[model samples]
Target: MVRNRELLSSGNAAFAGLASSFSELSETLDRLASVADDRTAARAAGLKARLEEFSAKITFVGQVKAGKSALTNILAATPGLLPSDVNPWTSVVTTVAINTKAPADVEGPTNTKARFTFFSRDEWDNLVVGGGRLGELAERSGAQEELADIQRQVQAMRDATKARLGRHFELLLGQNHSYGYVDPELVERYVCLGDDVTPGEGNPQTGRFADITKSAELFLDIPEYDVSLTLCDTPGVNDTFMMREQITLRSLRGSELCVVVLSAHQALSTVDMALMRIISNLENRQIILFVNRVDELQDPAGQIDEIRSGILATLKKFNIASDVGIVFGSAKWGEAALMGSYDGLSADSRKALEQFGAMHPELAGRDEWETAWNLSGLPGLLNAVAERVSEGAGKRLLERVRRNARNLTNEARATLMARRSGGAAVTVDFAGHSASSVMQQLAAKYESDVAEVCQQLRDDLMQRMQSAESGFVKRATDSLLEHLERHGESGTWQYDPTGLRVLQRAAYLSFARAMSAKLSKLYEDAARHVEAIYSAVLSEAEGEFRIEAPHAPRVPAPVGLGKTIALDLQSTWWRRWWQKRRGYEAFAKDYAHLIRAEANSITRDLEENQVASVLENARAILREFLKEHQETIRRITQPDADTAEDARKALGVLQAGTDTGAAFGEILRGLDDMAA
Candidate 1:
């Protein structure tokens, strides 16, 4: 394991290297983007966007009510930084990182603040329209008498959505909705609670849209923690809609460490297990299962043991070889203990602790309480995180810097060689083929490859669709029908008409979400395929032309509405609402077919259109790359002194590993002098 201090040193070195490398690369890319044609400039812009700082992204994710917010608060050393409560409150991704305040003297007092991004009107509309599972709601609702209440809730949701959405209620809204930052004191206004917390404040009738905020980035200056650390407080994986899950997954992408906060009382919930499988099974990520709220358990040790055993069994069942580290802790108690003084503790928390101490006489002393707090498992988890981060972060940073530096150097060399040759020099050929022919072949190959890849993606989508239809869809369908069959009451049929419509809408929306999620997965897989193909094409193109260029990372497609397919179910069940449970069953059966068809249509369009577009765009990028600097390459017969000097400096930096930054000479001299 990397020691904390050493890790910090290496991490700093790596960061400095990246900062220097990016400074140069971004400058070059900016110039290229500025001069290039519209298409080329756009592509270059995408590549430039990828040149971000290599911060160790630590993501906290889990099922709803897993104490993640509380844990984030404790880690940030700001109790109210995130609103942690028993209620399932937060619905947006909140990222916390060190804020190096610019022009330090311009600031009054240094304090943490958050910048929030609200959802576009369209995004809010989607969530409001996409209702949840009818079977789940029915199971929870219980008793035929609750049907009236359920309808009322549905009507309330509709009313609230209209009232909050205002102008957007009648039409699909765009992303032009405004967003702003909150003052340090009002951070909670944006992050904590829902839109109901502050009604008529910013976006009127924002209750239905409370879950629509895009993200919140909290910037803080904490002394104990390294400034390089970035903690991502992701939304619950099981938040109301599939889009929310997409947001969470996107945040987790390229994260260095993923901490899944599990509730001790709840343990590995169904959604928690699903989330676990996603991060552990699919991604190459270091994971920590933080079993939170352990204080709620009577036998925390025994409970933790049981939880670990279950987790291990699940991991084995899933064929995951990684041994996930488990940490049991209570964020509430740990935060209090870390604060040292109880003055910051809430009255309820203090009373609860006092009652617990009174109940357990042996643990009455203050030291013992502190010990118990320590035993909450935060200290060990913190140490483990620090060590793991120290071990991995430096290497990650260095690799990024090295890659950028190498790319920049190669590009410079190519430019210099071409410039000296005077647009006539041809050092090499592309695999025995001319550059023009090779470029043409590449375009054709990409087209063919996209078609073939899309076919494979379609097949995969169909297979997954079959599995989901059999698994989640069938289970949800059968369970609801069985419940309805068991509770056959014709007198309650009067209450059924409106209630059944509400339920049918909910059921259709649920099915649509399921299909949408599957489609999202397919899109992601297809994106990966396109990325791989693009990389392979770049390699081939470069090898053929005998030209070296900086290997810019594959630019990802931006998150947009294209990933989702809007569904408006036909009015087959609207007239049959009086038929009660049988009507709901029929509606669901018809709706499933519609959903399956929609899924297929969406996937086909993605396969034919989106996937092809990505490949074509990638091919265009290669073409642009060649066309952009070919003249420079051709013009170089012999290197000028200045050109040679610049190339030499770039090559020297590359040769020296580019990880030493500006202090490399000083360090090297010290080493040499010590040796002498």
Candidate 2:
């Protein structure tokens, strides 16, 4: 624990230093903007906004009852802020926005500290009427009984919701509820399942809105850290209804880091194949596996290695990366430590902490509470998160900010020198040079090429989806036939979806890699063109000034591809369908048709939701990149006369021995250091 803290302390200090540097840099930009031209001032303002808005989004994902909420609360340093006993079926994606500005999507009064967004009417209608993906699965599998059951359940839920909220239930859809302040009770009102309370009969404040709530965003102030952090507690993957699974996937869209929580006793159990599939699909993300509830183990010191080994083997078996960081801890220990209550600890927990402490000489003499906290492994996990942020998003943001700062500062210096040198007589011919036209041509070509690639990939994926679906149906049919032959259709036959999952994963990976690579190349080409134009413009200036090339935009990997399909569900639909089967030939044909129908939905989802979305995002990025660079070219080529005059006046004031030049030089040095 001492070692973990040391590492965590170091990581925190390093991240704090980086944030301080950004703050200092932003301040310098503010000062510079006061005496700079319009273009420079605008650039400075933009940089400031980017710096202020930067946040490292991290999500916690795991199977149901995996202690995700408890771990999230511990990490956020707000124990019990989120309901640890949240129902597994709750679809809300709770975000703890710490040390950050409220998200733009959050709407309400300025003082609103918590926001609960309800599902849109369309979304709700789809879920209720369509029975979500599960209904589609049931319908395709000919499981009339299951389909009716799901519809009944959804109807009951809706009726209960309407009873609780009355007419306001209809009004609340597609709207949000906001609060001036947030507390556990208020949160439970919207997020808890309140299974203890009979429908429409309990305290209205308890889980009254959980059924309709789509997401919850809580603003929190934690001054211990400097950088903005958004910790997302996603719905569990192993949800019974699979509604939360889709919600979880959407929650993971923009998250750069994921913490997969696992129970020590059932780490990577067969029931958690959904969790494993999620891990396998997050190929480009930083993953941390936290084996929670280690205190439940009889020999914490002796069992940890074995558990870790088993987890690694499972990951390998699923073709997931084995290099993910694994930490063993108990959220109970974290809670106990945070409350400074040692007496609250169970005998088993206390004994586990003692054994953990004994294994590490540095922890031998530490306070029992502190030792327990260390044994909780929160510090180590926190340190890992901090390290990833520093090396990944933090580093990338700093580099881009520094580059832009350097270019803007250098441009300001060059403009001042040119004015002083009386370069007004120089007639640099920019006639017939249309950066806009050239960029448009380039952008059009890039878009066309990207479209071609997307179409090709989409077609290929469609083919693969069909092939995989056919293969799955054939295998399932054969398995059923064997079962029928052996037991004469009297017993149940479980059809594994592992083969389908593998095929889907491969298709997703192929699409992601291809799109990522193509987008990166296109962006690089666009950036290069912009750089060349900027260089040409600079070459025509009075003095020698070198501008740094614009950094390539960070293209987010494809999302929605990792989503859980209807086929992934484990149910008795197969047996139920088989019970009404005819002869082997007729049974096989009907089964194939039904399974194919279900598989076709997966194809449509991938194409419409995943593939189309990726293409649209890529195009938007390309267009935005080109648009910004075109503006940059215009700024360089066509300077505003009034702004130039204002800059001259500001420069004259600085030239009057105000030491502002020295300040500017210091800012440049800071940027250089940051870049280094």
Candidate 3:
């Protein structure tokens, strides 16, 4: 505020300059998209990259009273996320992301649990008393004390949820994390709690009648698309007092797609109007206008045309398109469960069929359902979101991206006035010994080995050098663990490093990072060496006739042949979550038993050290691969530096010291000194 005021009092140069630059940049972006200046060009490039990155984030939004949640469920072809008890359950604005992979792992701020962390119908009976842990423990144990014996109650509940917790879902553990929501930073912090948490009753403050804690977030790993989709199911808008302001309004800013759900009974309201205002800014975004709870207005025979016209007019006034995008659907995700259609509906089916269609015609039209029994009415909504997301966001990426980059030469004109207006200013002079010679020597050494390593890896690995997920998981976990130790109850607002445990004990995550970094480096070394060797060797063979370059005999074969890393060691969901359940348990038990039974098995096979044996096997594999592809080998040990530079330019390769992970880079810099 002070800065804003000062700028306001002075010539409106600061803000005005920004605004003017913004206008120019916007126009420049419309015409010329790239500039020569590093910072400006980088910002534009970065924004364009992000624009293409989140192209699949489809959001369902609306007012508190609007049936956004219901419509989201309807679009998803499910019973829906929150209860449809005419309440405000979307308090927190949950975002459900779904990927192509099987839905098994669920992450939260506090824990990373798998599918078992979720609950089954029968299992829920024993776990919950009141909605919250603080309340449930107090009510179930018959305690009326100032502070509920939280630890004891938590322990008991933990026992009840033992089989399910680590089995079903994974808990991420923290205040900022939510279930079903996975950020790259949070993946390492991901504590795999199972999915079997059995949901009983959650808070009924809002119209929330049911709890789908297990289904809180949906993460689908669609390998076919090489993409993951997360669908956030927001808490009811009516429940928490903190919700009245609206977070969807804030979060929907960069959304590529959104669904505004309105109830047929209440076509539009003040709350709905406020929501539209937020969405109005996103002209580039696509929204699915879903009218939910058509049951109340089932007699479309009487009000169908009127309701349609009302909706159409409202959309027109708001400049929203009117088409099949506006559909009447049910907010109920599991109507079959509520309607009792599971027992092969006969009598009830006959009586409620019309109401079912009237209430959820959207489901009836879906390919997943239309079985007359609504056993899978939910599939329609889920598929619709995916379909619409793909279709709606199908615009040309290069064209839609419009952040223009101005010519770097314009800097001269823009800043020319700075000298004339200011005339003279305070100046400082520094005289320090230059370390050019030392820098030259250091640069030479780095350019010799590290540079070679980087070039070799770049030619071979491209973007595969770092696993984005694994990298992010480690960083995010470390960050959150630091946050926890700094603020968690056990630490009691004090982050201490009094003894050996200080830095080492920041969070278990620190140790995890240490391990992860070590593994990454090891794997990186192997992959880089192997790839560099292969590419370098192969390229040497390809350019055998070129007399300009020549070096030592470099084997073109795969680095380590039969000697391969353990297949299970790769970053995988099975290793992360599945193994924890049936696979992990079986492997652990069987391995333990075998280790006990066959004392000589280790000596014979593993030496019998399993880990070491796996590495040896990997090496063998690489060796054999090289022997087979011997023609592809390059005999050159190290290519000439000058020629390598020229080749890099020809191949569009350049050493880009790009560090967008600002925080990560800072940590790396700090660690570099420690490493040295």
Candidate 4:
């Protein structure tokens, strides 16, 4: 019997190509490390090392019940994942992805307490059954319950399942993360990880299956494979109304490709027909159809042809010009083959199995099929997809790099715009910046925004702080006035809020400017971290992996953000405000100590003060116009924050670290002192 394994049972063609790509990337990084000017090669080597953590992304997604779990069980080539007893039937999306390995293993970002987490199998179950329970993170306390309780419930559900699924793969659930008490390891995965959806309660659910959510995406690592393809396993759209909504909201409109599956017993339904039309409407994405449960058909062979023709007719009805493939097989049958369960298997099921058998790159005529060790044809279909996606390699990577680079560049510009004491001609050298120097420069140039971002980050910490403060202030201010009113009413007593001393503490917390300044420093600290990432990118950019922009500097571009300047735009009201604020020098004296402290804070780590000095000057300017980014955003955002101070702080936490979403949330809670 062939022992099922992650790569062995299922023949993965993408594995070889992806592995080759990884090898090239690794070798290229190593080569740069060996000879590139300025240890860029070393930095690239480091990034490459980190990238290696994402070495094997094995996506296992399909429509409804396409035996994805069974396939995973077979491929994991292990027991207990999709045991035969609880096997093949999955309503939830499960992902067993990998976190970082080797060293500095900070892999638990998908746990509870994580503002951003992917769904685990159990979490997926809760979503599949409960719906919005997965997205409960944004709901208010309603009639007066602690929001934390809801979060805890979500986390607990996830944590319990994760403990059960303890594997190398990082369990990432998109769209649906709420629903459980996840562990610390899973919690940390979201620390600074950024997601496509801009945080808040995104895409909610309305029914019983409210908890059912998008699938979990896993990036796996096999020994020789380098660039791992992210594997995703989806829930049955037909089963849940809310899940269908979530899928439409998150993936449909933007999908570059989609694989549709129809069970043999359940041919396309009205709902399926409608979904087919929607997916077909997408001009950019291609949809591949799978005729699942083929083994269940009475005349499996004749039915396969009829099913193909039937699907073609159905596709025509939906105006989907592309012909869909009709694979007559079963995830259960495939599992049976992989597990060595043959004699009891039906003869027709075995024949249907052999048909799918012919599609597998590793199992064709291998005699393994006779003993039932062959994997599904799904791998072949997915590999075909990989080939299509990889055809134009550098183009996609370039776009991705450029986009990320531009975002970093834009923030850098925003931070530095304030420090222009005066300089002309782009003929100056920008090499030789030390790590400490870069940190200081980052802190110095964007200190105010950084501080604001930091303060905003204190949200969770600050919310309860502010919520408590809000309560105290309201009571104190109102009660104090009422006491004086009562004195008038009594005519015999002179009274004040000596009884409500708690208000005094509240009063102390009400100093907006002080809160602003404190948050400013916090933001600066956070920005320092963001700058570190940018600095890392730039430090690496000047050498081997250096991005060549559309202009002079070569940089990675995504979505084609160009130097006509988008993310890294050089001008914003914040910078202008900073210039005006500093030009006065009037408040400089009062702020002298704070400014110096901030400058010291910025300069502390730097070996040289000059680079820090230049950066500091920039920050001095941006601090004054702290409202710029926020002001514009508010016009576009719903339930907008009243002031830029809060927004800037929030932005700082997000931009400051690798886990942008989580950091934004964590930092937002931290600066609760500023909230209303």
Q: TM-score winner among the candidates?
A: 2
> What are the per-residue Cα lDDT tens digits for candidate 3 across 260-283?
667777766644554554443343
lDDT per residue as tens, model 1, 1-676: 1012121122243244435544555555565444332333465466555554335678888877687877777666666557654224356777777533312322223442555567665554444443323212322323233344444554565575566557755552332122233332355544544434454465432234443356777666665444356788876766433445566656755566788888877777554544754564222326787888766666554566787787777666544555566787777776666565566556665555555456545545547435546555666676556556655664444344333333333343344333333323344455676443444454455445534544554455445445543443354455545655766423221111122222322333343344335333433443343333233333223331222222222222221212222232122232333244356556457544444443444334433543445444444543444443332332232344644554455445446675322232332233233223
- lDDT for each residue of candidate 2 in 72-117, tens digit (9 for 90 to 100): 7766666778888777657788999887766454457676679999
> If the candidates were sorted by their TM-score against the true structure, best first, what order would they fall in?
2, 1, 4, 3
Query: Candidate 2's error at 588, in angstroms?
Result: 4.5
Report the CA-based lDDT of candidate 2 relative to the real structure.
0.73
Cand. 1 Cα-lDDT: 0.49
Error of 3 at 21 (Å): 36
lDDT of 4 by residue, 296-376 (tens): 666664666676777777767654574443444565565565556666467877776666555445645466743244334
Give me the runs in candidate 2 sitting further than 4 Å from their true place: 1-35, 104-107, 198-204, 406-496, 539-570, 583-588, 594-600, 639-641, 644-647, 650-676
Best by lDDT: 2
- Give the Cα RMSD of candidate 2: 4.5
Displacement of residue 339 (Cα, Å) in model 1 is 2.3
Better of 1 and 4 by TM-score: 1
Instruction: Give per-residue lDDT, candidate 4, residue 513.
Output: 34
